[model samples]
Target chain A: MRSTVMYGAGDVRVENLPDPKLEQPTDALVRVVRACVCGSDLHPYHSMPAAEQGTQMGHEFIGVVEEVGSEVSLISRGDFVIAPFAYFDNTCEFCREGLTTSCEHGGFFSTAQSEAVRVPLADGTLVKAPVGDDSALLPSLLTLSDVLITGHHAAVMGQVGPGTSVTVIGDGAVGLLAVLAAKRLGAEQIVLMGRHQARTNLGREFGATDVVAERGEEGIAKVLELTGGKGTRAVLECVGYMNAYEMAIGTVRSGGIISRVGVPQYEEAPIGMGSLFGRNVRLAGGPGAQRSYIEELLPDVLEGRIEPGKVFDRTVALDATPEGYTAMDERTALKVLVRP
Target chain B: MRSTVMYGAGDVRVENLPDPKLEQPTDALVRVVRACVCGSDLHPYHSMPAAEQGTQMGHEFIGVVEEVGSEVSLISRGDFVIAPFAYFDNTCEFCREGLTTSCEHGGFFSTAQSEAVRVPLADGTLVKAPVGDDSALLPSLLTLSDVLITGHHAAVMGQVGPGTSVTVIGDGAVGLLAVLAAKRLGAEQIVLMGRHQARTNLGREFGATDVVAERGEEGIAKVLELTGGKGTRAVLECVGYMNAYEMAIGTVRSGGIISRVGVPQYEEAPIGMGSLFGRNVRLAGGPGAQRSYIEELLPDVLEGRIEPGKVFDRTVALDATPEGYTAMDERTALKVLVRP
Candidate 1:
């Protein structure tokens, strides 16, 4: 099998590797059908500490179940399934409460940007694709594994609903999808905060009612001005930087909520009482409970109610995965889908 | 008229003052029946900077309306009323949304520890007492102006309700009242975190199911142990110190809420992503929207369903207002009620 490996910063390679096999009673062997480079993957690609050897990369993938261990019950061999970014034993107390991302028995995808991979907790992790081998729906189904569901998580956490106004921060794939998610949830106004004209255009297409090109204080002022100096009812914090967090907090109304999905990078963010307490702003969201959301959103993608897969602006063969990294790093592509 | 004034740190005096007059068409002059020194009042009382003249003190009071301007409609002359800690024009958009503390035209109580006060926005700021001149209910009705309502705000903001477990992180007057509020809201289990045995005893009487005297890491461990290692579903942050904030954050389960009514004193509180995002903990609350809550809780107080006024352990006449401050400062009194 051929797999993508990251040796160090700026060093990605495609190399032949031993095929994965079912190991645990709950494990299943999956043959990769579709995979994508996630925004979070770039975090390690750009500055991860050097390693003595290459590490398997990719946590977002759709695949066909090649074989299943004895304990696997929910899925079977030859079934097309989406492997949510993280595998969880969905029966845990946390999973029961819809927090599968924090499941007691959960692990991230490993060696998934490859021809074959072993999925642990198979029964709980694999969501069978509603349609059989629909190549055109592959990108959309692949997104369900991570980014689309993540955007939906942000919207849910932000309490976006009918008649409410929402502000989405960032223009990355997830942010754009968040606009779509907020729209799907019936938000009356969706404000997308992105500086780039091209991405903001896509955001408009995805249902942004307004776009603010400014950043930092200027961006907050613009948002406040647009919302009658009250700020939006809900803010989607799709970027994890400190400034982005600050802006999300500043761009929300007195009783608004700020939902964050981007993996935060700060170790010590200041949460002043004068700001959060006085304004009654709520902050919530983390890694998406993709497994919990996948089933809920799968029918929408299958029915063409939402086309979140459009975020994949480029697609490449398994051998060109390294170029996918460079394209996204250079801002030349919004997202890169990989066919194995 | 006589009023209590703060000349400087450790200096409080009762001095004669001219009677207040209704200045605005919406203003009303009230003869104070009862007032109290608050935990927050102690903030300035302990170390307020020296000044050329004394500053008016007190924000919690219940009084009889002596005269009303032409525009004052909700309250009138001879009506006993409870003045919320903060006065606001109830017609504002914020006030309509039940956030009176953030009303467009809102001001905190000043010079309220006096025989007479000029109440601005009288129609919106005053809630007519259900019964006239019920001296036994004075303490309870007075609490609705601030402390009791503040505690209820913490419970409501924390999303406490039937069957949920809550932890109240203080044993002061507000904290004890928070326990009462949580119980009234149907919380199944209430944990009060305080070291003082007397205060914790009051907490128990107020419906605290458990009292954990430990602080910091030990406190967190105790709470986690109490809740089967899952932490409580809601936490009432009644103490504003950084340690209490940290404990509140640490004592809540993933997706739980921390409602804070304590006026936070720290300029910079650490909110690491590792703690907030990873756990999906929510932080909510500010100064209580007292006016919004007063009307709802007033009936309970008036009907004797709740007796929040029991928090006042000492009483002093207008001339001995300094002793009221000293009793609270010396930890000899949970609360001090002043009769002018």
Candidate 2:
């Protein structure tokens, strides 16, 4: 088996690795069908001093179950499944409450951009795809494992629904997908905030009613102007930076919600009493409970109701996964899909 | 007319002041029936710079309408009314969304510990009590103007409802009332965190299922222990201090909400990504939308179902208002009710 490994900053390699096998009674062996590079992956790709041991990479993948341990009852061998970014024993109290990401027995995936991987808590972590071996739907299904469902989490947490006017900040794959999620939730107006013409064009296609090309203060002003001086009813903060969070705060109307799904990078962000308190703004959303949303969103992808896979602007063989990283890092590609 | 005035740090004086009159077409002049010194008032009471002109003190009051401008249609002379701590023109978009504290035309009350007050937006800001001249209910109705309603806002914002478990940080008047509010909302378990035995006693009386007297890390650990190590589903952060906020963050379960009605004093509270993002905890609530809750809560107060006024541990004449401040500041009283 071949797997992606990060030796250090700017050093990604696809090397032959020992094949994974089920170790626990609840574990299952999955042959990877599709995988992708995440925006957060860039953090370690740019500078990860802790990766001195050549760490296994990738947490997003969809595959076919090749083997299952004795305790795996919900899913069987040869079943097409989506491995949500986090593995969780869906029977836990947290999982029962729809917070699978916080399940009592939960852990993140690693070395998923490989030929085969061992999935723990298989019964709870794997959501069988409705269709069987549909190569064209692979990208979209893979997205449900992380980004698309993450966008859905933002929309749900922000309470974006029928007649809501939403402003989505960031032009990354997650932001674009949030636009689609908000649209699916029946938002009346969806504004995508992105400066790049190419990304904004894709945003328009994803149901953004308007696109503001400004950044920071000007971007907030543009969003406020677009919403007639009062900011949007819901703001999806898809970027985790301080400025992006500030813009989300500034672009949401009094009493509106700011749903942040991006993996936040700041240790201390200014939460001025005068800002959040006076306006009664709500802050919700974090690491998406992707497993909670995968089942709900899987049908949409299988039925072709939404094509979130369009975010994958490039696709490469598993052996060439390193180029995929460079392509995204150099801004030549929006996202890279990996086929193992 | 006479009013309580803050001349400087530790200097509170009751002095003769000019009578207030309706200054705007939408204004109404009310003769105060009851007023109370709030916990927050101590912030300026203990360290106000020399105020040469002597600023008028007090923001919590219930009164009888003595005069009304031509435009004041909802309230008239002889009607008893509760003026929310923050006056708002109920016609604004924010007000329509039940966030009157953020109304486009809204302002905080000042100099309310007086014989008369000129209330702006009278028709929208004043809620006429169901009964007239009921001095026994005066204290509870007065609380509707601020503290009690603020606590109610905390419960409402935290989404405390039937069968929910809640942890309330702070044993101040607002925190005590939050316990009552949580009970009214049918919360199954209410934990009140405070070190003062006297205050915690009142908290238990107000429906606290448990009391954790520890502060900081110990307090959070106690709460986690009480909730079986998973933390509570709802947290009411009634203290504005940074440590209280941190404890609230640490004591909320995954996907739980932290409703903060305390006028947060910190400009930059540490909202580390490691804390909020991974657990998916939500932060909501602000300067209690008091006006929004007054109408809905008035019936309960009028029907003698809830006695939030019990929080007032002492009462003082208008001339002895300074003693009221002293009583509260020295911890001799939970709250002080002032009769002008």
Candidate 3:
């Protein structure tokens, strides 16, 4: 089985890894249909995370169930499913409360991002999709495994509503998808802040009414100006950078919401407590509890109401997974979808 | 008119000042029946604010409407009323949205310690009592002008609910009333962290199930331990100190609500963004819209379902306003009510 492994900074390689066998009654073996590079992946790519040699890469994917243990009743062999980024026993009190990402038994699917990944708590963590010959859309659906769900979480947590003025910081795939999510949630004004014309165009297509190429204070000013000086009613902080955090605070109106989906790359987010308090801003968004929003959003995607898969600017074979990682790392691709 | 004035740090005096006349059509004259010292007053008392000699100071009071301008129709002369700490024109967009404290035309009453005060937006800023001659309860009702309302705001903003566990930080009148507020809101478990035996007793009377004498990390740990290591579902931060802010965070469960009413004495609140995000805490609360809660809560108090005014542990004559401020500042008083 081939899997993506990181040997050092800026070094991702496809290597033959041993196939995974069910070690627990709750586990299911997933033959990778599609997977993608994530923004968090860039952390190690840029030498930001601890340098661990030969670590498993990637945490987002859609796959076909190749085998399932007796305890996995809902899903079976040949079922196509989107695996939530976090493995969780959905029956837990926290999971029942729609915080599946914080499930008490939650763990990440972290064996060398292989062809056959073993998913724990399979019955609760895998959401089977309607079987189809739709190979092309698999990459996009695989995105549901992370970015799309994350984007939707950002919007839902922020309480984005009809006529809400939404400001999205970070033009990465997740940020672009957040624009789509806000649009799906009925936001009237959508502003995307990023320099790349292609990604910003995707954001525009997804319902971004305005785009600011500037960064930091200038970007905040642009958002405020676009909002007629009142600032945005909701801000989606998609880049976990200090600048994005400050912009999220600066651009949100008093009593507004800031939903942050970006994985924190810094030790602290540069949020001013005084400003957050005085403005009465509500900061929300955590590791996306995909189960919370997936059911609600999946039907819309399946019906073509939203095209979240458009975030995939490039797709490659599983053998070229390393190249896919490099494309996204070098900023040549918004998102790279890899098919096994 | 006699008013309270701050001559310098630790120098609050009762002195004769020029009476206020109608400056706007929305203004009215109120002969203050009762006024009180507030936690915010301590800021100026400690000379933390821009020092101005002989600055007028008070923002909380209950009184009789002695005169009303032609435009003020809701309130009539001789009506006993609770004047909001911040006067707001109820007709404005912000006020219409129920955010009266952030009203565009709002002004905080600051005649310092005053026998008579001019209240702007009388029609919108004052909540009249249903009955007269409740003078014995006026001291408690006076607290409605600020502290009680702030406590209610904390409960409302924190979304305290039936069966929810709540923690309150700060033992000021507001904090004690927050215990009452949480109880009224149906929180089954209430923890109060504070000093002063009187305030703690008042909190217990108000339905506090636990009291933590320790401050900072120890207090937070005590609260978490009391809640079986998961922390409270709702936290009311009544003290505007950095330590109080941190304790509020430390004592709440993931996805808990933190309603903070403390006006930060320092320019910034020391909150780590990572902790806030990781814990999924929703932070809210500030200057409360007293008018909003007074009407809803008056019936409860009238019915003896709650007696927030019981928090007034001492009373003083208008001539002794100086003593009231000194007592509260020196920690000799939990709360003092001033009578004219």
Candidate 4:
């Protein structure tokens, strides 16, 4: 079997590795049908230290159940499934609260970029996709494993609903999806704050009613101006950069909310009196915990009501995985769909 | 008229000053019946630089409407009114959205400690009290301007409601009132975290279901211990110190909320991926914006259903305002009420 590995910063490789087999009673063997490079994967690709033993790559994937252990009941061999970015036991207290990322017996997946991988807690971690593995909706269905649901998480956390006015920061795949999510949730005003014309164009198609091609203070002023000197009720921060967070604080209207799905790249932020407190703004959002969100958003992708997979502007075969990482890193590809 | 002034850190004095007069058509003159020192006031008293012309102090007060300008419509002379800490026209966009603190024409009141104050935006800043100026309910009604409603703000922002579990940090006036407010909102489990026995005892009276007299790590551990190893769903942070905010992040459950009504004294905080993001926790709250909350909470105070005034353990004449600040600064008093 061939799998993706990261040896150090800027080094992504596809190498032959021993095929995986179900080890636990609840485990299942999945043959990867589709996977992709995530924005977060670029984090380590930029600064990770060199090591003799590189780390396995990828967490988002849609696969077919090739084999299942004795305890796997809900899932069976030959079933098409979508695995959430994180593996969790659905019965855990946190999972019951729709917070699967914090499930008591849960952890993230790291072997999704391979031809075949062992999925733990199969009954809970894998959701049966409504469509077959070869369906045209496969790309969109794969996104429900993370980004699509994550975008929804931002909207849910920010309490974006009917009549909500929202400002989405960052033009990344997640940000663009958030625009779509906010629109699906009935947001009346969707302003995309991004300087990237190519990405912002997709954001516009994703239902962004307005686009602000400015950054920093100017971007905040434009967002405020766009909303009649009062920023949107919700600011979805999909970029983890401190400058984007600062803009989130600056543009959130009094008593509004800032929902961040971006994994923070910085340790500290100005979240005290002068920023969040004085204006009564709220700071919301976190790791997507798509395990609970997949079922809810899967229907949209299956029925072709939405096409979140538009984010994957390029695709790569197993042997070309290295080039895929480089293309994404250099911004030549929005997101790269991987085939094994 | 006598007024309280702070020349610098730890320096407070009450001196005779010219009586106030209306300068705007929306202004009204009010005789101060009662004023109180707040926990937030201690912030400036701890580090403000000295000035030749000392800053006039105080923002919370209840008084008789001595006179009204020709434009004042809702309020008239001889009416007992409760003035919110901030003054606003109440007709602005933000005000209509229930964000009175961000009113376009709003500003905080600083002459509340004086014998008389010229209140701007009288029709919007003042809410007529159901009880007379001399009634015992005055103490509780006075709290509606800040503490009591501020406490309610914490609960409301945290989404505390029937069957909700919450933890109230700090046992100061606002913290104690928060326990009362959470109780009023029907929180199922209320944990009051504070080391001060006197204040914690008052918290118990206000319906705190559990008391954790621990600080820092021990406090966070104790709270987790009480909530079955997962922190409470809502952490109402009433303490402005950074340490308290840290505990807020530590004690919030996965996907829980940290509602901070404290005027955060610090500038930076660890609110990125490692803290709020990883757990899917939401940070909500800000300046109490009681202008919108006062009316909703007034009936509880007027009907003797709750006694938020028990937080005011000490009283002083206007001439002894300086001593009041000392007593509060040294933790000798929970809160001090002043009479003119």
TM-score, each model? 0.97, 0.98, 0.95, 0.98
Worst 10 residues of 4 chain A by lDDT: A287-296
Q: Go through the candidates in order and give the clash count of each.
A: 0, 0, 5, 0
Fill in the DockQ of model 4. Answer: 0.87
**Candidate 4: where is the Cα deviation over 4 Å?**
none
lDDT of all predictions: 0.89, 0.89, 0.82, 0.90
A1-340 per-residue lDDT for model 3 (tens digits): 8988887777788888788899999999988877878888888888834456588887888888999998999999999898878899999877888888768888776542568799999999999888563665676677688898898888988899898889999899889989999998899999999999988988999999999999888888888888878788789999987678888888988778888888765654433446676656777776885586778877777877788999888888888988887888789988888777
- Worst-scoring 10-residue span by lDDT in model 4 chain B: B283-292
**Who is ahead in TM-score, 1 or 3?**
1
User: Among these predicted structures, which one has the highest lDDT?
Assistant: 4
Q: Which window of ten consecutive residues has the lowest lDDT sum in model 1 chain A?
A: A267-276
Candidate 3 whole-model C-alpha lDDT, 0 to 1: 0.82
| Candidate 2 clashing pairs, residues 3+ apart or interchain | none
Which segments of model 1 are wrong by more than 4 Å?
A: none
* lDDT (tens digit, per residue) of candidate 1 on B1-340: 9998998999999999888887899999998999999998888987799887999898889999999999877787899999998889999998998888888998888888888889899998998886666579999998998899999999999999999899999999999999999999999999999998998998899899999999999999999999999899999999888899989988998878888888888846655567778877777888885676887898888788999999999999988989999999999999999898
Residues B1-340 of candidate 4: C-alpha lDDT, one tens digit per residue: 8999999999999988999998998999999999989888898899999888899999999999999999999999999999989999899988887888889999999889889999999999999986777798878888988999899999999999999999999999999999999999999999999989999999999999999999899999999999998899999999989999988987888889999988888878888778888888888898776576898888878888989999999999999998999999989999999998
Q: Which is the winner by DockQ between candidate 1 and candidate 2?
A: 2
Tell me the tens digit of each residue's lDDT in model 3 across B1-340: 8888887888777788899888888889988888888878888788744456678878888778889998999999989988878888888866887778668788678873688888888898998986564565676677678888889888998988899899999889889989998999899999999977778987998999999999888888888889988888899988887778789878988888878887755444433445666656677776786577888887877676777888777888878888888888888888888777
